[model samples]
Target: MKVTLDIDPGHTQDEIIIRCAELNDDLLKIVALANSSQKKVVGSLGKQTFLLEPGDVYYFECVDDKVFIYTKSKIYDCALRLYEIEEKFQGTNFLRANKSTIINLAKVRSLNPILNGKIEVELENGEKQIISRQYAPALKEKLGLGR
Candidate 1:
């Protein structure tokens, strides 16, 4: 696939045009990535509020009834519940690892099998999370990795 960009000084809106001879899984994935509607969410750390892009999130965790979104360097509290966050990023890069945590597959650096039928995933930032046995198969399927 070829990608081209046009620099229009007077352009008011951004647009993407795909010129392809045939559509395949790669093209479909390109479209899915380009057409991301859930671009950002609201999060707060202590007293400072900020907009968080899903691509920047390493994972989401629910602790003591509060939901926290983790990035590479910071953790922010979000107003949405775990279930809500799970539903929002369902078809995207986020996948549920357990009852209390949702992980971003894009941030994963390595995955290793554990003795308890679970998987130990190491994120790009060096943090690790355990994928429960119940969620292991689905995560492997998503990544096209054998169980």
Candidate 2:
């Protein structure tokens, strides 16, 4: 891959043009990073509201009737439903890990097949999430590991 930095004084905002014949996994990752939005999720703790970048989230989990956002060190309350959050961030790495959780594939460190056709997902922060048998195929396909 050849990277060129052209300095054009006329342009206001920087633009990127990727010249590739085929979109492969590596290239796709680059595209994701380049096209990443400045989007934030509003999380509230007590009475204070915090703006969190979607990339900072390890996963989103719903317990009882409320949804929570899990980051590296802290968890915050989120107003959106589990499915709504997933649908809003549609082309990104977030995927449904189970019926109640959506995990960021970028935060995953490794995937290991576990018992009963399930997968034990190890996140970058040393947290574990399970990919249910029903959702295992989608995870595999997303990671380009499907048959």
Candidate 3:
């Protein structure tokens, strides 16, 4: 893949054009990355607070009928459901590791396949999550390992 960046000082606004013969995984990844960078997290406390930084998030998990955004320092309760969060972060390096968990792929350090088609993911922050057999295929696809 060849990438070119052109900057014109004469223009007041930055313009980006991606020229590609076809939309492949690489292109999809680039698009996903750009989208994720622009995504904002709004807390459920009704204050409408936004978390702009992506690296500040450890993972997002659904537990006991509530959604929670886990960070390195704190955890914030979210109003959205697990499926809603999954849709928003689908192509943004976030995967549904299990029925109740949506993990940030960028934070994953290693993947360990356990018995009965289950897998354990080790996050960069040393947190672990189990990937159910049903969602393992999708996780593998996101990892670029193919089906």
Best by lDDT, which number? 2
lDDT (tens digit, per residue) of candidate 1 on 55-146 = 99999999999999999898999999989887777667789999999999999999999988999999999999999999999898888877
Model 3 agreement with the true structure over 42-129: per-residue lDDT tens digits? 6643555666466567788888898888877678888789899888877887788887888888888999999999989988878899
**Superior candidate under lDDT, 2 versus 3:** 2
Query: For all the candidates, what are their Cα RMSDs to the real structure?
Result: 2.3, 2.5, 2.2
Model 3 TM-score (2 dp): 0.86
Better of 1 and 2 by TM-score: 1
Backbone Cα, N, C clashes tallied per candidate:
0, 0, 0
Per-residue lDDT, model 2, residue 17, is 88
Worst 10 residues of 1 by lDDT: 30-39
TM-score of each: 0.84, 0.81, 0.86
Residue pairs in candidate 1 whose N, alpha carbon or C atoms collide under 3 angstroms:
none
Clashing pairs in 3: none
